[model samples]
Target: MTETPQRPLRVLAAMSGGVDSAVAAARAAEAGHDVTGVHLALSANPQSFRTGARGCCTIEDSRDARRAADVIGIPFYVWDLADRFREDVVEDFIAEYEAGRTPNPCLRCNEKIKFAALLDKALALGFDAVCTGHYAKVVVGEDGNRELHRASDMAKDQSYVLGVLDEKQLAHALFPLGDTVTTKDEIRAEAERRGLAVARKPDSHDICFIADGDTQGFLAGRLGKAEGDIVDESGTRLGTHEGAYGFTIGQRKGLRIGTPAPDGKPRYVLDISPVTNTVTVGPAAALDVVGLTAIKPRWCGTAPTGPGTYTAQLRAHGGETEATAEPVDGELRVTFTEPVRGVAPGQAIVLYDGTRVVGSATIATTTRATAGAL
Candidate 1:
């Protein structure tokens, strides 16, 4: 009997020392590709133990990745991306907060580190594609153009966070986990069946660079002390705060206000002005934004022709809203069919036509009837 021939494709699998990535790498090898496991060392100073899944890039994670590689009989290497992670992700996060914008570090990491940096290096080194454990599908359309779509499991779909990836990046990307119709528990069972030690490893939930999950404290230490006034929509001084950068839109707690609203209702953060160093709080109604302007549009394929309706997801974990997205010059103007709440600046608004990702952009401004500002 003649043996089946292997496909002539070299794949670089990004292993995060978790069951998902271990299973992904194993699946790649099972598909008869020349798979090489590469773990990204994103932390400059990794802790010895990863506490409660707070840090994903600890030294133990690297070791676990190596052991998984050994179990799968694949060569593995750790790429020290600490400098790039710091400059592109960590510093950018700090700067965005300083400018009073709420940025998603995970999206920045996917845009810069995983896709750009890793994909570029993989291509230069003669690899055909860069594979990962992301829960998002890359589908090739009838026109032979690649398009990103949500995973089969809606609960674990990560397509929103991966919206920044353009068509060119999607062309050379592979997501093993995305192809599966199974849950995370099933993936762990697969790892256990393969006798991988990381099969039962806890999934990391916090920012990789942040050892502790205290985002405010982390920012305070880096941003220092900048006293600011807590005010209402009409610029009435309501209280005082340590810094304006610490507050995010839609935040309700920790305002340090001495008095409550006239109606005694919960007041949400409406805006954070870095220049004036003011944090504005108002009723939940004020947070309802009807339309938004998004800049730096990135499309998975060619953007929708002219103006059209698309399902717009405002945040990573938010529900989809019906919106009409129109391309004006290079930016996009999205008018929501229903007023949405907590549309913050610097947050990504990913557009979708059905399940296929149309594009994404960073929200620059949000407006409503009576020209309510944010």
Candidate 2:
């Protein structure tokens, strides 16, 4: 498993037709790996899959990947991963919303599709490893455990989307874009130089599976229109919402509450209760949380058993917050060293030990610690 495995490492690049994966395939081939390109057709997603050179999944991106494979003198193929995407990503997303929880679909996709399904397929095909453009690094420890780490390119670092990948996946994963000088701008320039059609295309933003980023609209369209009441923390009727699934924690806009609070400050969605079919609203400060409890955690390498602390990031762009995490009663008790703001439920809280990614979990809920809620 050491010593670079072997030359001409049978590498399969999960090409997304983006500049990064395009360049990744080329580099793997240049490095003498038996490189091939695989584009996943996520047609089940009810969005415009018109991805550019910057976004991951789209028709244009697939073409670019194929073109790159051609340029790199490798076979190219597109697998119909639409069913898998629907069952694993789209269904999970809908279910999460239904349960009044926010979800990271990208993380689910990586967990179920790329690292889980694709990795399995690669192993079956006898390919040494499957590679991608994820801006993360996989290092195999001397103990044979695989560790995940942030890429040198911090801005484009995709460790958040990769948090669900466990040790087994990381061990067989390759990130050619881990250490690179290719910024988004630089990648586009290189693609243009290589005459890729997607080089000039604008990048995709927002959720890809949900078209137009109208999450509410998408939920209504998919999850059947259900009316619900918006209430305060004490269960007093405040207003009515379209559905409980439409609102999320820390959301301040589009409350549609006709009555204004006495303080005149806009109320934020503190939480949603699907069982009660109610949405709770309060001042902005109510969203602040002191700690969280995460179940079914996935460590990049292996879960540590100690009162160790690490940098816990709540959002992708969110700043680091210190947290003491320990396995308690089968859940990760993450008590933030400092009170954290907008600690939303159903979001991913990625834990890192310096540069290495320790683990991540979908935030189930947070409770005010003995120190009190943040």
Candidate 3:
């Protein structure tokens, strides 16, 4: 007697028209999942090619995604998420920057759009899960609870950005690229072997809305020019700047200050005051943070039972340091064993227990050692 084939899963694969996403969709279909590739039309006005190879969602990218879906033997559709993208990702990004905070739009998109919006729609439409090419893993515990973990390829791990996903989101998420310990080149080669047109598409980087990678210009266009003073940590005026939104923490160059410091040492941007519209330049030591407080913390599974040590990463692709994390009134406070630098408010502080992602939160404030205290 012949054995019956296993039934396919009803999957909605999000194809970003890149090699990674194309290969991911192909793999999903190859695994006998009833996969349907969907490209998100994020940009309201998408060009054929974006400037500086840092942009995506152009007409070419959508076409390439559709072609890849055809090669993978799956149905393809373009989902118009431009309005949602603008409201959730683009406008929120501008608002965060205007408030003198460093915001990660990629993380915001993953949190609000991909996993939240897309996943919700997929579930409503009877899809089992929303698949993506992100380099992160979703595992099931012995108790059947979903767990989010780092990718096997440590070099390409994207668990930092995905820390915002809660257990519900992780339950309906599938990452085909996370299980393998292969490099990105291997994925592209697989796409090529499968006759996918996006096998060699350039990787999208930088903020997608800012086509030329000129974030300052993009913000200036939306928010008209505003003059502000560039001052030292002591409140002494060093120079004047066009806008404070253009600056970020730890920025050294482009201060446009004619006067040098008394010590002739290079100064870095220590603080940005949206209230006073002042950009503060100071010594690099001022950027060192001994501790931080984060609000609206989201645990991937269960909140920590008690205070303990965890590895905290302040930025994407940044180094992690062992820190003591305590839950305080629905917020999290982390004290690093060793002081970290360039930690910006509004950025995510992802906590990890070994390789498993414990939780994440948006930094609200940083604590610095006083000069006299040291």
Q: In model 2, state the lDDT of residue 152.
A: 75
User: How close is every model to the real structure, measured as TM-score?
Assistant: 0.95, 0.92, 0.95
lDDT of 2 by residue, 64-153 (tens): 678777876799999888899889988899999999888888788888998888989989999989988778777666786677888778
Number of backbone clashes in candidate 3: 0
Task: Spell out the clash pairs found in candidate 2.
Answer: none
**Given candidate 2, what's the lDDT at residue 65?**
74
| Residue 185, model 2: Cα distance from true site in angstroms | 1.5
Instruction: Please rank every candidate by TM-score, starting with the best.
Output: 1, 3, 2
C-alpha lDDT of residue 61 in model 3: 76
Tens-digit lDDT track for model 3 on 297-364? 99999889789999998888987899999999989999999878888888999999888899999998
Off by over 4 Å in 1: 1-8, 48-55, 369-374
- Note the residue pairs that clash in candidate 1: none
lDDT by residue (1-374, candidate 1, tens digit) is: 11112344699999888888889889989888899999999876777234545325778888888999999999999999889999999999999999999999899999999999999999999999898888988887777788899987888899998999998999788887886688888888999999999888888777777666778888999999888899888889999888888899999888889888999999999989999999999898888889999999999899766899899998888889999999998899999999998778989999998988998999999885435554
Ranking by lDDT: 1, 3, 2
What are the lDDT figures for the candidates, one per model?
0.86, 0.78, 0.85
lDDT of 1: 0.86
